[model samples]
Structures are given as C-alpha cells and as structure tokens.
Target chain A: MPAEPARRPTLDRVLRIDQATYDAIVEHARRDHPVEACGMVAGPLGSDRPVRLIEMVNAAGSPTFYEYDSTDLLRLYRELDDRDEEPVVIYHSHTATEAYPSVTDINLASEPGAHYVLVSTQEHGNNAGPVEFRSYRIIDGVVTEEEVTIAAAVDTNDAAEEHS
Target chain B: MAIEVRIPTILRTYTGGEKAVNADSAGAGTLSALIDSLEANHPGIKDRLIDGEDLRRFVNIYINDEDVRFIGSLEAALSDGDQVVILPAVAGGAR
Candidate 1:
C-alpha cells in the first residue's frame, strides 16, 4: 500500500462583513487616532454574520495598547446573552502598526469563534486617503489570516416588490 | 460540582492536549482556589497563569465571558457551572 498523505486541519478563515459595518469600523478607528480603538460586533448565535457594530472605548488610551472598560464589557456581554447573541467579530485598530495581530493581541484573544479584525491607521490618518484593513482567526495561539468580503445589505421589501 | 476551565492553545501542553478541563473547587468556591485545584491536577500550570500572587500582565482570565480583572481578579467568587477562560494578550509590533 502506498503511503497516505497527511491532511491539514481546516479552520473557518473567511469573514463576510456588510459595507455599512465595515465603514463604521474604519470610522471608529480614525476617530480614535493615536490611541487604539477596540469594539465588537454581535449577531445571532452560531451565525457568522456580523450585524451590530459596537464602538467601545479604548480604556488603556495608549497608542500601543487597548482594553475594554470592564463594566461596559460586562454589561454588553450580559445584554447579548439575554438576546441570544454573541460577539461574532471582535475588532481593534493599530494606530502605528500594521493590520496584524501583535504578540499581545494574540495573547488576548479569548473568543476562538469570533473573527478578530485589525485596521491599521499608521500609513494614513483617518482624514487621509487609504487604510489597511484585515481579519484573522486566532485559535490555540495560532494566527491565520482570512479573506474579508464587504457585502451589500439586501433590502427585503425591495426584493419582494421586484419579485411581485 | 466541577467548573469548566477553557485553556488556550499555548497552554494545552499542561492539560495533556485537552482544550478544556473540569476542575473541582474543593469547597473553596473562589477563583484563586479553583486555580490552585487546577495546578494540583495539572502540575506547573499555575506558573503559566500566575506570577507570584497576581495574574501575568499579558494573560487575561475571564469568568463566564466577564473579565476577572474588573471583578476582583483572583478573589472573584465562583459558582457551579461557571466557565473560566484564560487567554494571552495579542499585540502586533516589532518583536
């Protein structure tokens, strides 16, 4: 018998974020320039879709570090739990670094199921032209970059009318 | 009853590769006690989670999705069926 090839483990590494949600994240990052901005997006449990955008404060208020206010985080989690939702996407911005998870960021990823999004405002200020946005899945101390697709929100009423 | 402790990938080696472990509070019912029991079962795991008396600066511990830092840290109370999660902070920059 021939030797069998080793199969690589597969992970959920693709993120589909709506255009509006994407823009809001960028705006938040720009608004908190020189200081890291951190927040999360909530959605129905088990749904990979990110529907709610939460703009959180940078408790650390440092360009190199960011932490969520403990009380606010607790309140948010409790609210989401009551509504049967979870943080589908946890995002933060890098003011002076690239859109990648730093060693510190990798260490702080608590939600293995949530997509970790990073936006870098280093090259261009929020008022300037370009920004670097990226997403990744940090599981078991491993970081894997993923594809981000900006999807357009579908209007259910418009769709129904067109079909009619 | 045993509390569930979710271990991060970097520290799985201490748990014999188990992603999560059920730890008995042994009637202490406190976060610190829970950690002590965990160390008793999985030797050397306490050092990774704690440095001296306080949690390592880079490590974040959460109880049922709430950060322990804000809830009295190691002194936080624990209840049956509570979930404890340990994660390292991730920051991107020059090594």
Candidate 2:
C-alpha cells in the first residue's frame, strides 16, 4: 500500500483576544524573569474552538530550565469538559528569547491535537514591542513550525491560516 | 512525618533559589498543602504554582518522576522520603 495520505486540517474559524487579554498575558510573562511563561486561550464551545482568553499559569522553573508542567493542561481539559467546551489551541510566551520552540520543546510535544503558539518577546538586550506569533506541531517526535495570521478579535478569519 | 519534596526548575524561585526543598514534614501531606506551605513562605510565588484553585496549565507534579495524571493528583500521598518534582508542558521545532 502507498504511504498513508496526509490529513488536511479543517480550520474554519480563528479567534483573537482583546487588548485586555493580551496585556494580562504579557504582565504574567514579565513577572517570571528568566524562565518561560505558559497559558491557554479558549472561548464558546463549537465546531470552531474559540481561544479568546489567556490564563497565565505557574511553573517550577529554574535558571537552567528545560521542560514545562502539564498540570494546567489537564485542568484546562477538565474545565472545558465540564463547561462543554474544547481546546482550540495551546499557547506560551518566551520572555527572554524569541517565541520559537527550543530543542527540548519539540521533544516534549507528544500530543498532536493541540497547536503550540509562541510569542517572541525577545528584547535582544533592547526594549521593543513583541515581534510576531509562531506556531508548531510535533508528529512522531518531529517538530514543524506553522505560520499564524493574526486578525481582529471580531474578524471572520482566524488567527491561523494553514498548518505545515 | 518528614518528607522529601523534589522541586522542578520552573518553581525554584520560591524555595529561596534552592534546587530542592526538604520539609521535616509537610502540613496536610497533600500536593496543594505542600505548595501552600511553600507559597506562604515565598510571598507571591503561589501565582506561579497555581492559578486560583487549579494548578498552572503548563506544569506537572510527578511523584517519583511518574505522571500524576495516570496515578493520583493533589490527593496523591507522601511518605517519609517521597519525591515530588514539578514539570511544565513544553513543545517546539526540530532539534
């Protein structure tokens, strides 16, 4: 038999967060000086998972940190399950570095259902606005970054266009 | 009862910059209580370990390096020398 065909993602809608939510996340990330910051986005349950909120989670991070905790992921899952919602995507911020996945990051994403969204807050020793939003997916231990297109919170288009 | 708690890198800030914090004995002997004692002394570190009553989304507390989800969560017990390490959910590009 030929190799298994690729499964195209059917992402019909993308949800954006208001300025308030954005500020909340940035503040949270800044509070944790050196280690990485993590959180999630969610909205009304539907065919298109709406990720509209960013909840800053806590971690046991050290200066030489490698991995992030998954306790909050489980709690998010349970909360959504109880509220009759679903996980649209998973998000985290890189405070001291670009919003890209490190080597350890790829090795840890065993789940394919969630999309990893990274925010490049790298200051490069200078202060500037957050650069961009990047995304990724890990399959069979291989990681592939995806491009995400951000739009107005009320825009018909989603924050992401396609998956690679 | 004296218990040994394994601390993950992410939350080391709260334990006075120590890699691992040992308690002669934890208060309630539960994960929540363990964190509570840590936060009470750390002053504002609780927000980093938990979000409200729920543990932070990206972190995990393993009893002896095994996933607590597959076992038991906050209710997971502690012995005289049990080890609890906190971990976070991380993902990314090719190495």
The TM-score of candidate 1 is: 0.69
Tens-digit lDDT track of model 1 for B38-59: 9999999999889899988767
Residue A127 in candidate 2 has what lDDT? Answer: 40
A48: Cα error in model 2, Å: 4.3
Please provide TM-scores computed only on chain A for all of the candidate models, following their numbering.
Answer: 0.86, 0.63
Candidate 1 Cα errors over 4 Å, as ranges: A1-12, A154-164, B1-30, B38-49, B58-95
DockQ (CA atoms), all models: 0.19, 0.17
lDDT of 1 by residue, A87-142 (tens): 88999888887887877777667678888899999987668668888888877677
- lDDT for B61 (candidate 1): 83
Interface RMSD of 2: 8.0
Ten-residue region with minimum lDDT total, candidate 2 chain B: B86-95
C-alpha positional error of residue A147 in candidate 2 after TM-score superposition, expressed in Å? 2.4
For model 2 the TM-score comes to 0.48
